[model samples]
Target: MNDKINLNYLESYAHSFTEKVCSEYFGTKKYMSGQEIIQLSPSTQVNLMVIKTLFEKWNEELEMLKANPYFDYKDMAVTEALKEFMNVLSRAIKIEKQHFIPLLEVALIDTVLLAIDPLVYFWGEIEKNPSPFHHLKASKKYIKWHEKLFSELISKGDHADEEAYKKTLSEIYHQHENQLSSPHILLQDLNKVLPLDWDQLIPKEEILTETAPIMQEPAQENPVFFEEEETPELPQETAAPAEPVDYRTSDQGEIDAPKPSLGNGKSIDPALAWARFEAEQGGLLKGPIESLEEGIAINQRFMFTKKLFDGNPDLMNHAFKSIDECDSFVEAVELINERYTSRLEWELDSEEVNEFLHLVYRKFDEK
Candidate 1:
């Protein structure tokens, strides 16, 4: 009736539910909801809110019960009291999954308490029996017993109830400080799943890291090189150099100027200018005609030669030992065309090919 929940009173209602009565009504000979579990209408928030508060109240009561030594009813090495409390909760809390989280938190807390109680009991026994051999051995023996189940349970619930699990583990950790300090299984919580019958699967994580993605630096088009067009310009003659070009022809006694003029320079020797000024203007008098025209001509000659070779391949009838010895392109072409082209007759009649060409030319055998 009170807005505040009473955990003890609720548990009593659960304790009073008879198994036969449970079977008769709810048809399960198991945990019974203590008449107070919230089963509010889907549209109502108030009842759900009250149930939420009661869920917290139940958790507090379970913790209080643990603090009192009297409620450790499952004194067995592995206790099922967590299952018992969850049964009470399944009955008392709203059963719908959307409302189940807090009730589940209750079960988680019970497991936390279950794990913690053994350490408390073992140490308490040591205090009462105080002897180096008896107490130390007693502590180690119980710790060994606890470790078997403790590791598995903590690992399963590691992330499930982080804070409470950590607290419970830390208490057990320090209480049995030496034993817990030994090496732990280096399991990397790496999870994978497959169909039930599949025994093994290649972990995507392993394969992804090992393989490198294919590097396709986008196709770089062959950069085009074109010849700059040459323009005729007047020559600026440079003064003759001291090295004395016997500009005279060796056979005909006459002076020869450098055969072709570089044109822009008026002296045989280059002119001098202030380095800074020349550098600032980005180099003086680089006639685009001299630099780009020569390169353009070279590429054009190479491209033309390539086209001539490809367009009319010189086929050979029989191998010729030498080209200068053979003397002409006509001599080469006459020999090979007779062998390769003469072998096949494409007068167009295979059942498949004729059918394909027929479709292409005649639409179909329309009749």
Candidate 2:
């Protein structure tokens, strides 16, 4: 059955379908209405409906936040930012033939793949020795049962009855164990059940690839999958005068402010700071947190600026500098609320916002 299915052909068909949908709906229309979306094929409609529902939920969450009286002015700034974000999403988005074609292909591919081979679609390509019982796990009946079981477990939350959950699982497995068909037979039933339009798109010809038999290796004790050496700690050294680094300067040739101390009225060595900065490149910020007053790390600056401030470096710099001048976290947050949020319209619910604010808290926190 795998030999008869053409993965490439399926992918191409998905792309073609996505292009057709985009051209018909997104070409002339700025935003697709739910009424119009309902007219699309059932498979396409399912994905688009999900997107539409989520967009509605986003608006609801913003409204809920705005109505909460306990939220401070700084937190309320998120509502304004979210409103602007929604405007951009709804109005600015246009179908770019080059970019948008590939975007919708995955959803279409999943729909087609599910109709053809639910086993491979859900479990990925099975490797090594195969079991008939394993294949039965992918059957629609079993999948539905698994979903229901988990849904009940999740609904019960922290107070869930573990024994009841276990019993339910046992009952479900035993109930379906004797009644389930073989994996190959289930696959045939799935193909038969596919919508006529999709069934027509798939080619009848078989294009099989040759595969070599797997040779099992003897098991060994405590096999390590991955290994990494720990980074050596830098030795403590006397603080040197802060010197200008080439990358630390803005395009206008103004050098960044001096690095903050580690709250003990002592500055880190300039060489050590530079070395730590270099090590932190291409990864997340790590400790020992030398100083919150230090300029934002290069990677973090780029990410926060891009995600929150619309990739404007000058705006990010201005916000950071303004925050640095404030004497306390409260003042810093007030500055952000008045000057930045309304003007720049930052997305408040974003993880980047929390991360940026945490750094601000560290700056004014009693060390």
Candidate 3:
């Protein structure tokens, strides 16, 4: 509530978090104050706005997790919490364009707190101490215990330099792989664990100092050298072709055409965006669909879907019709492709628009 109290709580939470991780990774019992934690690297420029924003978001998610019906879902709740923390850390870093370094460090600290430490601290107290207030009160012993259910509730949910954060952390962890331990070792093997991008986040000097030859293995083991395995083609099923319409004729039924919305601002039509997304992803429907569901859930959480659902009711119905009627996921996507190809009107074909459409469609799927 009060400024001083909030600041103290923030620092204390961070301190406990950092201390646990540092103790595990560096094998040091040193108590790092929150300020010291923030100052781990001389290059990092701390931003209070970024730090406060991170804490507020984490706290909100933690509260939601604490209220989960643990019995019904079994360990689903626990695993969801860990995954949620991972998502938060990755996203916090990915989104913070300005204070990236500081945010990345702080978020890593929180990730270790929520994802790793909780399996030890919170799970022990969770059954006995069900209330979020009670769990939070035990902060020193169990940092953010409530975060165990963080990923379970309705949520929203990466890549490229867009993933500069993970790349930065992987580099840091790999550079110090020998010096660090346990989870730090695990974090360093990021490519094996999860994919990330952006090599420009860290200073060259720091990266150079730890230039001990990183152990390399066979092609399969080394992600950098591992060639992308070509996707196996699915057995094609022929369907009766729909009546043809010349997409180049006009912008009338053409959803792919770029048009100014009600306002003068040029916006890609949502209908067209969905089409291009399916087109680009091609047969890769599983990953995109999962992402789409997550984005839709987030939109629902933020109340962004209500107005769209209220207005374009039929459009929404038609979209889901593809989902329900199509034989397979790829078929579902093919339906989208067919819909767009029939009405396509864009002058130039841009892969960039396809990429952007893939991103936007995931955020709002038709019900």
Candidate 4:
């Protein structure tokens, strides 16, 4: 449970995992599929799932902003910048070793922090020592809220009573589970921390560079006309155009106007793009649940069945199907209360129950 023990274990596990992946797959494949990812250790699977969830939430925010009637021309730049940022993140679809390694490293750190102590993770310690992924504006707000809540909970509880501490944390988490599950609450604000030239942070091979155009032979019967252009002449005293200034840094060591890269008319709805990408990869669904009829995701299904249903696949399937048949979230909750909760004598405030109910709520709580 100590920090050093956790850090050593994580480092050793990650090193071995990375070496296995590189030697076994990196030699031939450019991207790792979700199916392949599912075969990884449970800890790694959960970490990747966290990364995927963050990406989906980021995409959802962009879509929300893009659809606003009040969205103005000024907002368009931010929208497009976010879209491009999502694009770079979509590299996770065909995640190269270069991209995957860094992402996994950050994710593992986050996992360790959360596992070791939720209080420490939410107390702004993670924010103070941020990785690129942690430089999110929403994260600051999220941490601040949790920090206050945890502080209050600690102040009101017996510090000597570990069980009391656990009970208080669970109660607080359950009380705010709905808000905690909402995606927008954690929506990232790229303008706050991400640099204008954020793409440069990625590896050269992982960047989506524009490909060179191919030259085609022109037909002699219809030769194309070309307009000749004159080149500008430089003065003898010209000093190499002053080495082109970078607005991110100035002589005064302050940022000037940082122009984020706009989309090149290639921006598409992130949800649609992910749908196409997931289809091509033939992997389990990684995005948000659009409908219960589509069924619970593989990860969720396995997790819920194991954790809540006592590894009863049939019970899990039937419960989900029954919940899906309900016309509304209220009806779904009633059904769970009557059939599952009451019958199984489930603890409503338990983390597993809250997580399961949260996913059900997501199915019906459409924006």
Best by lDDT: 4
Q: What is the TM-score ranking, best to worst?
A: 2, 4, 3, 1
lDDT of 2 by residue, 328-365 (tens): 66677667767765566655544455456556655665
Please list all clashing residue pairs in model 4, or write none if there are none: none
- The C-alpha RMSD of each candidate to the native structure, in angstroms, is 43.5, 22.8, 22.9, 27.8
Model 4, clash count?
Answer: 0
Question: Model 1 over residues 323-366: C-alpha lDDT tens digits?
Answer: 21333333322321233223322122222212112111111112
Task: State the lDDT of candidate 4 residue by residue for 182-224, as single tens digits.
Answer: 1112211211222112222111213222232221212122111
- Which wins on TM-score, candidate 1 or candidate 4? 4
Question: TM-score per candidate, in order?
Answer: 0.16, 0.28, 0.24, 0.27
Instruction: Give lDDT: candidate 2, residue 352.
Output: 55
Which 10-residue window in model 3 sums to the lowest lDDT?
243-252
lDDT of 2: 0.40
Residue clash pairs of candidate 3: none
Q: Count the backbone clashes (under 3 Å) in each candidate.
A: 11, 0, 0, 0
* Model 4 worst lDDT window (10 residues): 240-249
Candidate 2 lDDT trough over 10 residues, lowest sum: 243-252
